[model samples]
Target: MEGLYIEPTETSPKVHFDPEAFSFEISGESRPEDVRKFYKPVLDWFEQYSNYLYWLTEKYAEGEKKLVQFHFVFEYFNSSSAKYIMDVIAKLGDIQKASPNAKIQILWHYDEPDEDMKEAGEEFETITNIPFKYIINPD
Candidate 1:
């Protein structure tokens, strides 16, 4: 199945989800004027991806496990964006729950001295019960 990619804007983030490469990332500031409209497609892509993952698991029961990396790098985001961000993570959590053979790694990248971002990642880790690898970026 094909993946999803969206260019970033001043008040939005860049989203790149490559299924074949098993790499996904959402980066940049997010405060889109219409939060729901901006995030709806992203959420939809994950639903489709979930279905695709299901097919792969059913078809390749004996195949090797798949390792998928999801990176969340945000410089800033508003509360509305945060809600959709959590929704995205929830979708991922759902994927993880449904597919045991697929290893989903969540990587949270934050700039140096940004304790809020780090703490946000930690909160998500706790809420979703999904492990996250925190990467500190130089300011």
Candidate 2:
């Protein structure tokens, strides 16, 4: 599959989901007035990607986990966006559970000056079934 790429807007983040590379990334700020409308395509892409990987793992690559590496680098986001983020992670968890040779690693990025962002990542880790890596970036 090609991938879903969305340019960053003032109230939303940039999304890049590459199914071929098995990598996905969302960065920038997210606080869309209508969160559902903004994130529906993203959630849909995740679902399709999950199904594709599930098929690939079953038919082609057997014994290979770690099917995806997802990166989340948000400079800022509203409470509503937080809820959507959790849903995205949950979708990934579901994908992992459904595919026997499926694994996902989430990397949460935050700059040194943003302790709140760092804390947000830490808090999300506690609630998610997927493994996460907290990255302290100076950017």
Q: Which has the greatest TM-score?
A: 1
The Cα error of candidate 1 at residue 26, in Å, is 0.5
Instruction: In candidate 1, list every pair of residues with a backbone clash.
Output: none
lDDT of each candidate versus the true structure: 0.89, 0.85
Alpha-carbon error at 30 in model 2, in Å?
Answer: 0.3
The TM-score measured for candidate 2 stands at 0.90
Q: Write the per-residue lDDT of candidate 1 for residues 1-139, one digit (tens) a residue.
A: 8889899999999999898877799999999999999999999999899878877765556766788889999999998888888888988999988887788899999988999999998988888788999999866
The estimated TM-scores of all candidates read 0.92, 0.90
**Candidate of highest lDDT:** 1
- Once model 2 is optimally superposed onto the true structure by TM-score, how far is the C-alpha of residue 39 displaced, in angstroms? 0.8
**What's the lDDT for candidate 2?**
0.85
Candidate 2 positional error at 64, Å: 3.1
Off by over 4 Å in 2: 60-63
